[model samples]
Target chain A: SAVISQKPSRDICQRGTSLTIQCQVDSQVTMMFWYRQQPGQSLTLIATANQGSEATYESGFVIDKFPISRPNLTFSTLTVSNMSPEDSSIYLCSVGRDFTEAFFGQGTRLTVV
Target chain B: QQQVKQSPQSLIVQKGGISIINCAYENTAFDYFPWYQQFPGKGPALLIAIRPDVSEKKEGRFTISFNKSAKQFSLHIMDSQPGDSATYFCAATMGDAGNMLTFGGGTRLMVKP
Candidate 1:
């Protein structure tokens, strides 16, 4: 299993502002994923980030709202742009090393005010 | 459409009892099924997983039962303890290059002593 570290454990952002969450893996990996978990709800895949390529966003999510950056194999970032109350949720960074199993970071809890 | 659906949004089990969570998937292409556990203020962690080729998989006290014809899978936790209390999520993926996942609505399990 890979050890993932995500920053800002939590943050309170004002409406119209943006918050960028960072993810760092202990070892090199091929793919990293971003997810959003609303309170008392299931997790929704936001995007798939591959090294040296543009992140692929899932349906109902767009890059403009949740832009991702994968600078290398072990690091990635997800920025929630133009925050709103509806956008408040827990953002998680996940890495799948063996393709079958995934490891996750502690996640960043964002609250829009 | 929600590709994966989980039942019993919340569950309460006594210590040393059995805890069961069920999930079903609508996408036939999904070949991989995984169960994740998440505590408050933490990201979801992969607890166990199974492939459609198998009927069941077990690790410690956690077990995953898969039924291909019904497109359903379930997680069973035996000898429940308070430390096992957490939110459980069932997820499915196609086992392809992207390995994009679709998650079911979570089940919050509370094991009382």
Candidate 2:
């Protein structure tokens, strides 16, 4: 298992503003993923970040809306661009470690006012 | 189309009881099914996982029962505890999908003391 951490555990931002959530893992990993959880709903994969490559976004999500950066194996960042009231949700970072098991961060709770 | 679907949006169970959450997938190509448990204010942690080659896998009180023919899987928590109260999610992915997960709507489980 990997120890994952995310900065700004909770943030309040205006609807027109954007927020960048940072994810740091204690060890190097091959794949880092970003997801969003709408209240009372399942987590949706926003993008998958690979070191030195552009992110792979899922359907209904795009890089312009959710840009991702993976500078290295242990660090990644996800920016929710042009936030809206509907963008208020919990953002989480996760990665697979040892075999196919996956683990996640504490998550960043964003409230767009 | 929703790749995965989960039933019982919410459930309440008593301590020492059994908790069952079910999920179904539409893609036969999906080979991995994983269940996660998330506490409030925290990201989801891997609870149990099963591959298509296996019908059932258990870890302590958590078990994953998978049926490849039906493309269905379920999570069973035995001797449920109050600490088990949280949101549970079932996700699937194909190796060729670049590891992007297709998640079902989560089920909220509340275990009473």
Query: Which candidate has the top score in TM-score?
Result: 1
Model 2: colliding residue pairs: none
lDDT of 2 by residue, A1-113 (tens): 79999998999999888899999999999899899998877888888899999998878999998999999999999999999999999999998765367788999999999
lDDT for A32 in candidate 1 is: 96
Worst 10 residues of 1 chain B by lDDT: B93-102
lDDT of 1 by residue, B1-113 (tens): 24899988999999999999999999888888999999998888889999999999999999999999999999999999999999999998876744467889999999999
For candidate 2, the TM-score is 0.94
lDDT string for model 2 (B1-113, tens) is 24799988999999999999999999888878888888889888878888899999999999899888988999999999999999998988876654467788999999999
lDDT of each: 0.92, 0.89
- What is the docking quality class of candidate 1? medium
Per-residue lDDT tens digits for candidate 1, residues A1-113, read 78999999999999999999999999999999999988888889899999998998888999999999999999999999999999999999988866778888999999999
Instruction: List candidate 1 stretches off by more than 4 Å.
Output: none
Error of 2 at B103 (Å): 1.5
